[model samples]
Target: MKKIMRSLGLMLALLTLTVVVSACGSKPLSQRNVLKTDQQSKTITWGVKADTRLFGLLDTKDGQIKGFEIDLAKAITKQMLGKDAKAKFIQVTSSTRMPMLKNGNIDAIIATMTNTPERRKQVAFSNTYFYAGQSLLVKKGSSIKNVKDLNRQKGTVLGVVGSDSVENVAKVAPNAKVLQLTDYAQAMTALKSGQGQALTTDNGILYGMSVQNPDYVVTGGTFVSEPYGIAVDKAQTPFRQAVNQSLKELRANGQYQKILHKWFHNVKGFDYEEAARE
Candidate 1:
């Protein structure tokens, strides 16, 4: 009996030690240094939207995602991690981007994410790389011209889930009913089916949609300023600073302007020049 008790005590002690060691081995994501890891790996994985046109879109032909945000991420990665350092992209939606970053699936988020105070609490943001504003898109002959029109008619507005557009619409047009879809593609589809009077989102994005569907137009211009930023994990201060520095360099070297022109020069109803850094 004495020997069996001693054996049981030893097993419990070993189990406790193992548990303590396992707990110590697992460090929180906030404590990990993403910059150092990226440097060592010679790659930075970016979480980008695969649906937002003009910002990030998956080209069905080549099965590759391309757009202004993808170009910008490539430029910034090259600028920060040497020209040879590679930039990898992982498709993310508005609803998944934050959770992906928090889980360390991607190093940063360069999607068309607005830098609002609420988001700032969850992740660190780089300087405003792009400036956008909220706007409405409607069929060319539609009577809805703006937020006020929606309010007067008490119409339904289409917005993407996990985007600020619906909340903005609610604030600006309290009478308008908002239908939040899973993504821009679905919202656009709902608009075409006459489910909603207007599709609301960033003006840049609306312009992209208009380019593809000539029958639609961005109406009422932009009502709210939405400055876009690159989001990193909340603990990734060094990576965020590095991104900000790269943006500054890109602006000074004229690369930023070139990229903006590449994507927006032909986009109707959008002033690409206004987005240029002075």
Candidate 2:
């Protein structure tokens, strides 16, 4: 009787565990991937940055996130989900976006994320949407003209934690010391406080920083190529294909060019013509 009771208790425990596991199964547009579900819901959620201007930033006056990436996300959402589809934007940083994507917190990531081998292991990426390059930010009169100039014993470069820029800085300026901060804002503060001689990151991001602070300027045009792409969960084949198709359509319709001009036309030294290439 004791043996039979023990067996029954073990079976009950196993059943309870199975029930919990089934209840916590994978989320939608992921393992259970469905583009139609989003269409039916009339809404698509997108992960975007609220800090990176020209890419994505919050418009304080309107209390809405706006930028090239945001516009592109909206266009893609419309292209996939119909003209009346509503878009929900969630603020994400370089560090948080991928995890949020895996957890199904956002339907897609249009954030300025670079496609890399390591990242590819975790998520599926759409075709290259934008071409960016790593560059440096320094005080207006600072002598740091390029990546080569930062290769010195006393040279220190600041980058955000979880950003590829920190490792790239070592590759480009091997002799320079590197410090990783929490985010771009902190890295910029360190640069301004003389914590580091320069803040290194994507040229597009550096350009945004320069726009906000006239005292700083981006120097040394792109030491490394960083192509940005839209990210989707590896299982979301339908959604991924839709995003790539939308991108091709956007280029064909000249809407891509219109978006580029809307945000980057006023940015000095930005080669809008070259970026127009699909």
> CA shift at 273, candidate 2, in angstroms?
2.9
Q: Which stretches of model 2 miss by more than 4 angstroms?
A: 1-30
Using TM-score as the measure, the top candidate is 1
| Top candidate when judged by lDDT against the true structure | 1
Give candidate 1's error at residue 27 in angstroms. Answer: 3.4
**Candidate 1's C-alpha lDDT?**
0.91
Candidate 2 is scored at a TM of 0.89
TM-score of each: 0.90, 0.89
Candidate lDDT (C-alpha), each: 0.91, 0.86
lDDT of 1 by residue, 151-222 (tens): 999999999988988898899999999999999999999999999999999988899899989999999978
lDDT of 2 by residue, 1-278 (tens): 99999999999999999998987774454556557768789788999999887888888999999899988888888888889988899998889998888777888888878888888999989998888888999999888898888995459999987788888888868899999988787888899999999999888888899998889999988888888888888988987898899899999998988988898987889987555544
Clashing pairs in 1: none
